[model samples]
Target: MSSTLHAEQPGTSSRGTPDRWESQRSFDELGRPLRDITFTVVDLETTGGSAEGGSMITEIGAVKVRGGEVLGEFQTLVDPRQPIPPFIAVLTGISNAMVADAPPVESALPAFLEFAAGTVLVAHNAPFDIGFLKYFCEQQGRPWPTFEVLDTARLARRVITKDDAPNCKLSSLARAFGSTTTPNHRALSDARATVDVLHGLMERLGGLGVHTLEELQTFSGRVSTAQRRKRHLAEGLPHAPGVYLFRDHERRVLYVGTSKDLRTRVRTYFTASETRSRMGEMVGIADSVTGIECATPLEAEVRELRLIAEHKPRYNRRSRFPEKTTFIKLTREPWPRLSLVKRVLDDDADYLGPFSSRKVAEKCLAALHDTFPLRQCSDRFGKTPSRTPCVLAELGRCLAPCDGTVDHDTYAAVVRQLRDSLLHRPDRVVEQINARMEALAADERFEEAGVHRDRLAAFIRAASRTQRLSALTRCPEVVAARRGDDGRWAVHVVRHGRLAAAGVIPPGTDAHTYVASLRASAETVAGGPGPVPVATAEETEKILRWLESPGIRLVDVEGEWVCPVDGATRHLALHDAVARSRTELVPFDDRRDLTPVHQPAR
Candidate 1:
């Protein structure tokens, strides 16, 4: 509450507080013109400080104006039906005698409301006046009509510096703006004074290019002419769920965004709400915005991921180079060791990932090595033994297949075990981890148990993702459809885990003709012959995502499109246990080399 009984915006702090005001009202910049706004500048003189403090308004005054011209005015003294306090009567010069002949508040309020109807409310410190009026309406059991409110105090703070105007009080602003009418606590005189203040703040806003009712409602001084010029880009977009592209002068895609309401979302770029520095830079270079309307948000999301993969737009920092996504593969060399590679080679090799990045692939690799005793050595080993065992062998992390310690047949069996663990039987992997965890816990070495628990969690996470992705990759083709806008069907054809074709089948058209046409016109995203790799991690991910979207009808599917009955994720109970143990700080962590939080028993 303020000294003048100013109520804060519903969930915000006062003017002197360090929180930005939260406001929401619908006003389109292009659709609703600001010049047509019927502004009712209002003021009130009350007997007490606060509405809730049993205060009653003595006088209500307002001026309705538009385009710098006064349309109408309202002023009235109300018989509070209660005695006015001595200080308030003295301050407002509205004594009991002055209002003796005045009508009671019950009758006067209706006339005031009629005069102020269909007008946007304006007040220097709005909450105080509005609060009093609202309380009166509530007391009379009359529902208060809602009005779009503009606080000159907030507008002044955004426009004027503290050095120019020490504060945003109506009298202070009126005097600063060189108004002839001085506020001396009389309601009509003060309301008239505030009208000048309102116009003065609007003048400041106009200089800042906030000409629309929408722009002024969300006023900011940073709106540049260049940014505002781009508002036209959003003007033609439909208010539907879809993906939007921001393209530059070269017709190169600079940024891509998805929105349920394309028009509103794209228009926000020019407003003050878009506080991201990179977004401003994106908007500065952005010449046009194009929208691709989708039937569902899931389709929009999938489309966004695919576009990000294909274009690799400069402003899109993530998934741009889906080709850069790495994979962990067991090579077909004589040694048959694991290696992280970018492209999935044509050579027959056991592959695990399509991991999001090199770091994640490396992390998964490190986690896998902690449990599996496969050959960690990178060198090719013929039918004979190569170099002696290395440090990893000494640490018992590797099977030492490079030495006679592990024979060729034995190493081959171990390689098969690792392969089975990755592709088909992660159940064995989960069992081995649980056994190790149980041993650690039985010895009362809980911290080590925690370490084991965390490693199990990481291994399961990587394994689960890799398994899911590999399943999709192995599918020869998948055709799916979702209901599109205007009663159409949005169809996607996936070949070898990449978008083969995409198009819409209109409501009245024969579906087969459009599908064939779409496939004919379809640009090859993947499965094209070239030196450069065509398919991407994101492309496969997009197909998987769309398949997983709710209400997706599977048109057709090829290959074994099913999860293994005994797949790695089957031991979901183990995953749950590991998750809980880690949370209890059975103390699972990745920082194994860091300082010991507790000294475990030897």
Candidate 2:
């Protein structure tokens, strides 16, 4: 990175004596006075972009400088636990193999933060790096530190003579300063060069008596001129879903973002109130804003994902959050055992989670066991059938499907009940629990009622996790497509009112085409609503075939749009719209005058 800017030794004023330089008439007209200040210049490589959606940082570097002199520096490689794009590897020369052996981000970020403490941040493009750092810190439950930021590129344009230079590049500045060192693209080198350039700008501006860090932090270019440019850029933006890139005068990317409405989102940062803080600082650095329009909201999400993945833009947060959070998997087997597993595992088992904690998963399982009474014993114990039932049977905790006392069909029915409970249909669980609790209470079985009450609480806890409930008579399915404003599309596969999977298709593709493809694939399944085959009565399979299929994405499922790919049933919302429209329609004969002759009766 520093190769772009040549490194210079400290205390070397290429210009005349400081006092004489300050007296220059040209410096007084064009520059602000410079002040001694400390700055922490930082940079990061990340897995992807959107902070909220999912992205992680892979590396970070920070250099501390005071009064144009280097104090210390910090740098580290982060293991993202995800595949690194080939281009990023080539550009940063930090390969997947390199990071693969490094400590994960959890261990590296805190160290970087400690080094960055107590200094104003300086970056070639500060917003991109700082935004990502802020977002990542927030996700880790760490407090984000606030600091003034100075953009070297912005300072260059303001202080450098346009007549003397054809272009304002870090390399050009390094060359002009007669510095021999070339900064490498790696974090440290770029940060170092940025530091050098900042020093040079300060030296030139010091002649104008604008000599303190505080003044630079609050510096704004010609008020009317800056406002006019901001307004012009805001006016040119279109109201569409798309990604926007903010760049400074030196053409370094400052920030990348996706918005449902580009014009509105971009314009917000230009308003008077927004311009006073970090965003204002960014605008001050930015010479132009560029946009890439997406055809639909989903396409915008996909593009944002791709860009973040590709560029590792500093401001995105999507990659920093945990991707393998744990959840409970209640197998669709005869025994229907519940087990804890990470959400990212590739196992041939039915799973549900990305839940916040294991306690929540356990509570849900316990409630389901109480309500459905499915066989919870291990298969080894179940097959060991003794003359008397196991402890579970004695405690009324199992229906004893093991001893042939409960038929296979009956056991399967119980399993279905357990599955429904796991799917968050608490009404049935509540009704059954209420009846059992009432029976025990009426019989003076106070202990049993109390146990049932505890189970009911757990049931309610699980139900409360879901935000919506579907009222479909049978399992619901939906095929929905989200088209981005740039014509890209995202196809979602929903099953039993849950988001099962999603796929991104190329831009300009029709939403209906992808939905139709999913529908065709789902139609081949045997027993379930999806394309997975179910076991026959003779096959006492340990797991349901359809439940183990890899095709399903398995997200929070609910509503009439369950299997959106099927699209056989229309949502009530759509029906209501049609109904309302029909009622408002007027016949042509009643509203129009057919005769050209004058209306004498009027």
C-alpha lDDT of all candidate models, in order:
0.71, 0.55
Model 2 CA deviation exceeding 4 Å by range = 1-36, 47-55, 161-169, 220-602
- Root-mean-square deviation of Cα positions for candidate 1 versus the true structure, in angstroms: 23.4
Candidate 1 lDDT by residue in tens digits, 327-378: 7888887667888887777787767666666876776676567657777766
User: What is residue 342's positional error in candidate 2, in angstroms?
Assistant: 56
TM-score of 1: 0.54
Residues 218-335, model 2: lDDT tens digits: 4433333454467567667789778887877776667677898998888866653343233455666777888888745444554555565555544444422333345556665445
Residue 539 in model 2: shift from native, Å?
Answer: 62
lDDT for residue 142 in candidate 2, whole number 0-100: 93
Total clashing pairs in model 1: 0
- lDDT score, candidate 1: 0.71
